[model samples]
Target chain A: MSVVRITTLSKSISNLFKSLVSPLALNSFFVLLITLNISAQDVDIAKGKSLYNANCASCHKLNKKLIGPALKGVSAKYDKEWLYAWIKNSAAMIKAGDEQAIAIYEEYNKVAMNAFPQLSNEDIDNILAYTDYVPEPVATSTTVSGAQSSTGEPSLANDIILGLLIVVLLVLVTMLYLVTKTLTSIAEKNGIKIDQPKSEPFSIWKAFIKNQFLIFSSVVLLLLSSAYFAYGYMMQIGVDQGYMPVQPIHYSHKIHSGANQIECQYCHSSARVSKHSGIPSLNVCMNCHENIAEYNGEEDLEKGYTKEFYTNEIKKLYKAVGWNEETQSYTGDTEPVKWVRIHNLPDFVYFNHAQHVSVAGVDCNKCHGPVEEMEILYQYSSLTMGWCIDCHRDSNVKVKDNEYYTKIHEELSKKYGVEELTIAQMGGLECGKCHY
Target chain B: MKKITFFSVMILMSFLTLSCFDQSKPNYQFFPNMYESVGYSTYQESDAFANGIEAQLPVDGTISRGWVPYDYPDTNEGYELAKKELLSPLEVNDENLSKGKELYNIYCAVCHGSKGDGQGILMKREKFLGIPSYADRDITEGSTYHVLMYGRNLMGSHASQVNAEERWQISQYVISLREKLIK
Candidate 1:
């Protein structure tokens, strides 16, 4: 009992000490204590941090309210024995009509906390210690600056070299001009007449105009080139191949698909079964975004995609979904996000995402380009008849594991006298296949 | 002077034509009637709806085709009851397990970890914290389905993305992962 009292007293003193010292000083003090290998409490704190992250972090945050209340300095609010009982089985305490437990349960909309019967009293103490632990401010700015400088060096040197080359070229040109000017002046002074061939070249345009054959041929050439250009321009009409539109919300495919490695079909799930790939509803965004309210990943500062910018975009999502971050509830007022469509096929064309994505096992990247790498999505394919026909002519129909194609694949391969049958041979290039 | 004027005019015309190409806007179609659908397309904007959007929520109490109604309430008591009583309707087989694995990898594996070890890429990157491992949790097939139907805590309901059969398949896969973890 005396030992317990003494440890409690020590804990109070440490808590007071923690409040008094600045982060830098406290960190230094901790380093000194750790090096001395005398502070067992510090070790407990470390263990507590890991334990807290493993068990408590999902619902409880130290400085902010998540599913539960902010748990910072929780030890100060309740008795140690009571906390132990509560952590072990809060539902039991609530049912038993414990005032504190019931109050908490009611306060958080009767959302009962998950009981950690697996965690012992010692582990709870460690977790509590972790909750009270104040992390030292890391020297991340210095490291970031160092990285920026290192990466900036090559580009900076290249710019300097480029500027030097330009300056040299300018100097050479000026020197040539100066030399020619001085020589001309000297020649004039020395009475050496420098004949200027100016009028003859100026009349060359007139001479060309006078030649009817040359004029006619040139006019024909101009007309043919203009016709060719007009045809090229006409062909490109309504073919939105690189048509990138800014979305209502800035959704970075690079971060989600590339950095996070989330599969394309995870959000565009209808691609497996439906005609359209389907623009994911706002609820899909909430699947991951509900927990991840802030941006902690990489940033492109030059493009103004900062942590705050990304976080604000998330706030826009919350607004559209009508999610109140503080209370963690929907306000029942929703503004549907009007996402601009990037890829569109004309009404005349019949295209099924499921046919390509699931049946054929065609990769999304084959048409969508490297969507994982794109920060902004754009139409990668021209979606023209020629483009479709080209792919159908070259690409083989995926026959493996498809029972429906078993007999047809064999017959077609035999008829074509080829080892494999292209999609065109499989009637993919038929006019009726795409046009209805 | 006339030639210079003509050349300047040509340059100006070229610049005017080239500058008209705006990437943000769609290009001019040969025939708007043919290019655009006369019938309402997916996500088309029309004055027919009150919300000024094409997609409308289903009428109250109207069930969609193939959508099985989930009777379990979204409450702590419901969670406990579901955990205790809910059973998988689908039979355990290689086909279901394989399909479950594929779906799980696409959706659950992002944060839940592929091995159900609570050490997914998101966890490692510190995006999500305190994701309990399947072995650590007191879970059953029922609880897993319940959680998937009406998402518990931070997770949102994936019912929209996956159907009932897919959910059961995923639940079976999760149980299998838990079994593997126990060993």
Candidate 2:
């Protein structure tokens, strides 16, 4: 009974010291919580977890190295008193030439850590405990998901394809057998028996062996079919319609475009007027990303990308843009993020994004495919000459209310006697329209 | 002979299967010269170019063909002066308003919000604060253009992103949004 009271007394003192800023809430809640936690009074791991998440989560992760180092077993690395002082004011210690403090400051590229003067020793301890806390592993969930989902393939599609192939093979075999049987029956009915001659050589092509004309024609047919297939394979050599490259950061257009409904022109603003749909510079990223430093999607891992994966990617952006989220100021340590360009038109093709987008009013999705739903962007269109010519031939010119085309439209309509004039009709098919 | 034929058929089948899988690879171009031209990249530095820079800047005090130079300087005085004087060159119509709305949603709404109440995604998430409501301010099309031309406070200049025509269109859209917010 005495031991129990002493432990409870100690817990209240620790919690009181931890929550000094919010004393009234702590005192009132501690009384209620004491009854529930009367027996095992130790480091409140849950309280620590919430506190760590609220304050330190933006720059720190428990197991992974984030903007700051991982906090897992961080309590073991330094003395309790030192940690308390450092956490409360790291810059002061670093300025004062404290060896350990200066080392950490330098280790993280001289980017100063934010001071948490309000967090008490006990509160810091609670955070440390939460970092050390590990839950039991669940292997079943990962295995179950892995078995169901495979990249570039859905199980249903695979089954359907296999079923179709089997059906095709069965039909071909049945036809061949039927044809052979019918021919043999016809020959037997007419008493034209195909007998083995004593003088004839034993050849594999017995039927065509004696007939030079039949052999020559069959060989010619085989050669023509092989050439057809070979020509088809050669034609598709450089047409990378579905080329998906891994970028420096895993930016999901699906979440930004589809889920958030950010307009395509918002980031790629130059697409409206420029020849190229420009890759958004880092400054464009910082416009929203300065505030949106963390990712907290209310769902399971998407396409095997865990919560940690996306959160870290955002951190990489911060590092690249030299943003210090703590003071919300740039740290002046900027580096250019090398992004791999996906859509590349050949030198011969003079494609103007503005001509198609601003002038013609083509949707970005018409050429880029359904980018809104893409987890990773890829070249959506074949972008062949035939593809461009086809679009120009069929697509109607938007000349109704658009001022840019109205004058040209009136003259063309009178000349051609057609109200709906395609882009092809408006000199879109001219060699000089795209080339030179 | 039969075994050799079977092996050859198996080899052909494997080649067919492999071809089906390489979907990400592009088709071959007949002429390499057409595909890859001998030209300098836009941003790449060249030894022969001045300052090793490829893109050249226009002479000072000169504007491009379509773009007119903004007269007012970037200052508080400029903002105040433009507010009283500046009026949109373009008239208020469905054409301008829709384009204005579309442009607003692109550049401004990410911070200022679609409704212009300053409760954009950045505000709702508490990433940034203190963005004033359009209705709260006494603004004119000129002030809006001045702000876009040379940014105020936390917002940076958007002159590079928008043209003079687009700037006018956006000012029209913002004025309409302000009227809606006033109600």
Candidate 3:
């Protein structure tokens, strides 16, 4: 009876251990799978978010119905296939007399949803998947906690370890030096002749003066330094790399480009066709600022001296155009916003924004280094002839489907036997192309 | 060796000073009386004078300054390219459209309608009839450019009030608003 009881107790204990280990292991495995899935989903969601913000956010909202219907339960409301078809070309669907599409079209007072044939099925799926994700209450709190702890602990620990390692390395090097010095001193004491002089160490300057080899090297160094200085001075004669000047208005590209995501072309529309990506006029501001009297963002509000970012900037514009913003009407005492032009090319050099932006299809970011990311707009690219030539030499023109380049692409392909044609190959680097 | 080095240093200093003095004078100083130096009267009697003396004469003392003329090769090509590359000139948000509509109603609705239908109060009152809806006009980028440059029949030149690029933007916005109306 005693043996049986002991055996039963042992069995129960083992079972308890098994139960504990199994769930813990299972929980970790589940967590690993979940983390991987969540990250992958997050990447797609991020892409969808950007796409939504760019194309759809202007008309549609997630929770609230704006110009279009609320998109909160859009995934559940329509099947994936139907949603894809509707989003791609709503007008087509309506024309085909699709009941659901026609009903939505009528419901929205027949405000036509802009066709997005460019959007792919995968993109729509990702957008739908993003919408379907529902955050758990506990998960939200844990994420916040995790973010705080991770941000603080990892960086602090990394800094501490780096500091400790540096100190240890320094101590080790010092000890090694000391050991060598001690060994050398001991050898000297034992009447072993050392190759190095026992005389007091001379400073580099003194040595340079006394030693003929050092003197020759110093002369060479001096000559090289002068040559380098002369070359650098000539190269940077008009190159204003860090040229930040006070503008007529404190127009922050950080605010407009970075925060607001105002496309560069919105103001610099001339970039497409004309040589200059021209600065926008007061009327352009009036188009929007006529309604957006105030900026909603906090950063703009705090640093923005004149009530609103646009209002203050518009005030500067008003001063240029002689229009007053205070009374909600034009006072007609305007001055042109004499914005100090940042990028100035040499008289001989010719640069065209249209050629780069329109013909070459080079992203503004390629030359401007993510102007949208900058707070205070600064000249990002060197805008040098060499820089332009280098890019032209490297960058292949987007010739496919471009009606303008179709004929050129064919002729070039036949000549070179290689389909790829760089801008340089297409006369981008010619002296006349840049200079004339 | 010391004597030779000292003499060389002196020569170098004198050369530097001489070069500095030479550079101090302006480029035009060589020809103080450029008209007299060129012998303007003698050139006038020459057979080349028949074409125009103004063309023969060198540009007075002022440097050419190498001003590159702003070349807009093809206006139509430019507008099409701009449309493809540039963001919309007007921010077409709800607030912007609302303000645009309001402005259109106040300033433009007398001729162009609240919905830009070309049937404003002015048209109803018969003040100006046949104000074409923007959509009805088979407007290319060039046609818009032309209209903006030189005003049409009744509409006076808005070029004075609006700058060159703003006209393009207004044209773009007008086209967009027209699109909205037709739809």
Candidate 4:
């Protein structure tokens, strides 16, 4: 009986060990799987960095505020889902009477946060992840100075490589020429007889008449050259791509658009609705210059008329509009500001600023090529038919959740099976759309 | 054979050279005016009158060489179609609206109210009354466009404060706010 009991007890102990060990192993396997999934879903830090610079870096610092609240610890304050919702549509949430949102709104003295509904959930997640995983801050001056020094690294390396390549190519060509010359001289010195080339059996005129291939090639070359020249001539027939004219006043787009970040609409207010982005009159300048009275930049100051320069420009506007700054009133001697218009399309062609700016949702930078970045805003795009059509062909229309395009969306889906609909697909390139 | 070949080559080169040579200078064309054409004794003569008319008639000859006629039709349908297809400019999107609203409140809310109710401090202070609530007006895209173009009532034209499209966008936002208020 005791022997039997000992065997049974040993079996039971072994069974218990088996059950415990099996569960632990399974548990570890699941834990490993979960960890892998989380890592896979973790935000891409690189993308986050770029998105931050493009959108958020202008206003908010990681640890301090420039224009908006510091974004650091923002991820900790809100859950991922809440943060995404808040970032995407903060105003809407506040309007919907979310208490937390309202408190934040009130705390900021009702200064509304800009809505970013266009941002995908993934993008917001990435931004949040970036905020959460703050790398230790490097010393600002060191990094900035280091960046300045490193700026020339790529260009310097490229120059050195290019110079070396040219030298090597020159040496190779020289060697080949020298070798050929030496061989020819050696052959001549050895008195090796070389045959003179055979002449054509026919007369020169007759030979030219007989050579069909040569004739055909000559005709083809002529036609090709003519066609190439004609094509270039036709392309530039109406397009004033780099038409930088001397303006009546030396208004620098580079100053206003580029450095100040004063919006294009600040001056060209008519872009949204009118066919023309009407040049702002002198009165518009008076709106701001009335108060500013001086150019704050060192360059403007160095140009001798620091105080008198702006005063003179304002006076010019005053002369146009007949305003007296001393009286802070209109003198009625106002002459209309004769702003030399830029970006002139042909009279035959009709271009509307409103359509591009307001409806299709293209940024001025897309066509104007970073006017804010320009010192003197020149016409960046060719503003040609081909250029317009090419953009229409490539650029996708902004149609996400827009009620204005609900019918269009339905029709487009039916026609193209819900593929990405570009502007060209929407008859943007139709001749009547532009030419008329 | 060599001499013949050389002579033919020379002839062919000469033919190529001769084809491009134009010795004559281009003549400047002079077009006389109709009045000049009917000059001297016939200048003052008129078919309607039996006797001599005015001594000189206005000359008509120097027509604009570069002038091209406007080709597009200007009918109502054409205008409407053009307006719909090419003129209905886009406004600020959700992204820009947020930014616009932020900008608006900073600059405009002091006078226009957060809701654009026109009950802003200026209104409250009795400085500027009758600042219309966007809802109160029968504002279409066109009418809204007109008001923005030429300032209505007491408010001066905001042409300076915003660009044309931005004003339109602000109009869109105002319309949107109006819709919200109605809701």
Q: Which candidate gets the maximum TM-score versus the true structure?
A: 1
| Highest-DockQ candidate | 1
lDDT by residue (tens digit), candidate 1, A358-422: 89889999999999899999888888889989999999888888899999999998999998899
User: What is the TM-score (0 to 1) of candidate 4?
Assistant: 0.41
Question: Alpha carbon lDDT of residue A82, candidate 3?
Answer: 94
DockQ, each predicted model? 0.73, 0.24, 0.03, 0.03
Model 2: per-residue lDDT, tens digit, A68-100? 787998988999899999999998999899999
Clashing pairs in 2: A236-B27, A237-B26, A237-B27, A237-B28, A238-B26, A238-B27, A238-B28, A239-B26, A239-B27, A240-B26
Q: lDDT tens digits, residues B76-154, model 3?
A: 3444444444343454455545544433333355556656667765455433434566665545444454454444333
Candidate 3 CAPRI level: incorrect
TM-score, candidate 3, first chain? 0.51
**Candidate 2, TM-score vs. the true structure?**
0.62
lDDT of 4 by residue, B86-178 (tens): 432665489556655654553455446779776666445433334556665445554444444444322334645555555556656666677
Docking class of 1: medium
**For candidate 3, lDDT tens digit of each residue in A83-177?**
99999999899999999999998886666776778789878866776566555666777886686677568778999999999999999999999
Regions of candidate 3 where Cα sits further than 4 Å from its true position: A1-210, A300-314, A325-327, B1-183
lDDT (C-alpha, whole model) for all candidates: 0.90, 0.79, 0.62, 0.62
Full ranking by TM-score: 1, 2, 3, 4
- After superposition, which runs of candidate 2 have C-alpha atoms over 4 Å from their true positions? A1-204, A211-214, A298-303, A403-411, B4-17, B20-27, B44-98, B110-113, B118-133, B136-143, B146-157
Q: Pick the candidate with the highest lDDT.
A: 1
Between which residue pairs do clashes occur in model 1? Answer: none
